[model samples]
Target: MTVYKQLLSLPENFSFRINLDYLKSTEDGLFRTDQESITRFIVLDGNLFFIKIYVSNNNRLVIETEDVSQSYTKQFERQIMLYIRDWFDLDIHLEPFYTIAKQDEYLKMPISKFYGLRNIGIPDIFEAFVWAILGQQINLSFASTLKDRFIKNYGKRLIHNGEDYWLFPSPRLIASLSMDELFKIGMSRRKCEYIRGIARLIANNQISREKLVQLSDINLAVKQLTAIKGIGPWTANYVLLRCVRYPNAFPINDVGLHNALKLAGSLDRKPSIDEIKQIASAWEGYESYATFFLWRLVY
Candidate 1:
């Protein structure tokens, strides 16, 4: 009785196909993807909506969701549009980054290869934090496996069209969880503690996306996140790059980034931190975009 449909216009250089490929890269079970569309449940303003996102024949982005829109306020409408913009990063214009990347030797090929690709964002800061923790120091496949197990055990689900769609576990749920529960899902002891701590911070109103974004600069933001236990520079920057909408965040020590650079430059071994800095010199204002394209090479 509450399925609502909306269409969003795309940028001139946005590629729905490339972003979809990235979303489908990991079957972490948060969303289900078919050939052309993806369906998932998202929590907005404490309301749950199962949404299907896909491209329309007219080249616009379409979102269909189940909710009682008949009596919804304007804030609800704004929230949905804003969430979609952040989720797919629709408002960002790629022309400037493309201009700079087209000249860099290491990035030139990838920029064209993955042209129109946006750094698909995790709008829920808590979900982004959990993902960064889940992926820390592990291969993507194993990290994904852990996430799949964690969500199935702890996250809520909605069944529609005879398929189940999952919602990332809420902060209140994780804050009250025991380590034993998460350990059953194969997460390390430290990761379990870190996740619970982060959840508690958010659930208790100590830290939230609004608070993080209120910081004046990227360093302050990074410092705030890194100040938390188990969140190093790499994890902090990863969160900023993916969730905080910081274009300058660079996780210099990311192993996937090192491998990508090594393969692209034909280096004898993985690039060291110094080499990564020098190689990234040309990627001043758009380090997040640079890293996303490089990650496409190996991930």
Candidate 2:
């Protein structure tokens, strides 16, 4: 077992509640046992099993890792929590988020139920990019099926406590995979090509999280990613949200988000893309959290 302690200084009303709620529900990849101040993740991958137990309150994060200490496990732990904070805009002051939440009825409705969605992010740019491609235009259940197939086929494993936990496959391993191999795992040809493209970029160190972070402007970064074949606005924004950990990253056209907004607002008609943008604008700094909450509505 390995344990690490760190204190995260977050503004008031910076709740991990919503995040916990998300893990409990949306993570088929892991199991979450919700507790008042601590939530646990049990990850099983083939022959390896690992658990991440997160205890947070009053702006402090305590992580307990058991039966796994590979470099990637540590990397996974660091990246996942960081992604959650970035996804929830926990670094930002709560005043602005609260102001928007209190003032805008749409924002208010979602935040009221923010505790039911998961923040699934892949910090590795290649993995995140590939995941976004795999998920495009598909229902999430099918997406999960695709992910399970991919993981089982390509991912590495750790065995502990009579169980297995898997890590997302490495870029080099994925780059060597043939389209036929991926097709056997239920990946479409287009998605296979996109994954290979991402793998090539990572294997070559051409496009990376470090490089993307230095781009300094979200719009420019989005344009750069979209320049990649098969990468669209949703995929770009999803990468920013998951890989770059951009607080304001919002996949405006996400079917889950659109459906969640319609359900929450009790609208006669689903909000237009423009309307969604307009309503989400107030929560600009906390867009990820707002999106998380809205996505929660579906789960």
Predicted structure with the largest TM-score when compared to the true one: 1
Which pairs clash in the backbone of model 2?
Answer: 22-117, 45-164, 45-165, 45-166, 47-159, 47-164, 48-158, 48-159, 48-164, 48-165
For candidate 2, give the lDDT of residue 161: 46
Off by over 4 Å in 1: 68-73
Go through the candidates in order and give the clash count of each: 1, 10
How do the residues 110-228 of candidate 2 rate in per-residue lDDT, one tens digit apiece?
66655233344554577677778888988888888887778777876545445555567778898898888878888789889889888988889988899887887788988998998
**Alpha carbon lDDT of each predicted model:** 0.85, 0.68
- How high a TM-score does candidate 1 get? 0.95
lDDT tens digits by residue: candidate 1, 200-261: 99899988878877776999988888889989999999989998878899999999999999
Report the lDDT of model 2 for residue 65: 47
Residue 168 lDDT in model 2? Answer: 73
- The lDDT, on a scale of 0 to 1, for candidate 2 is 0.68
Candidate 2 residue-wise lDDT at 245: 69
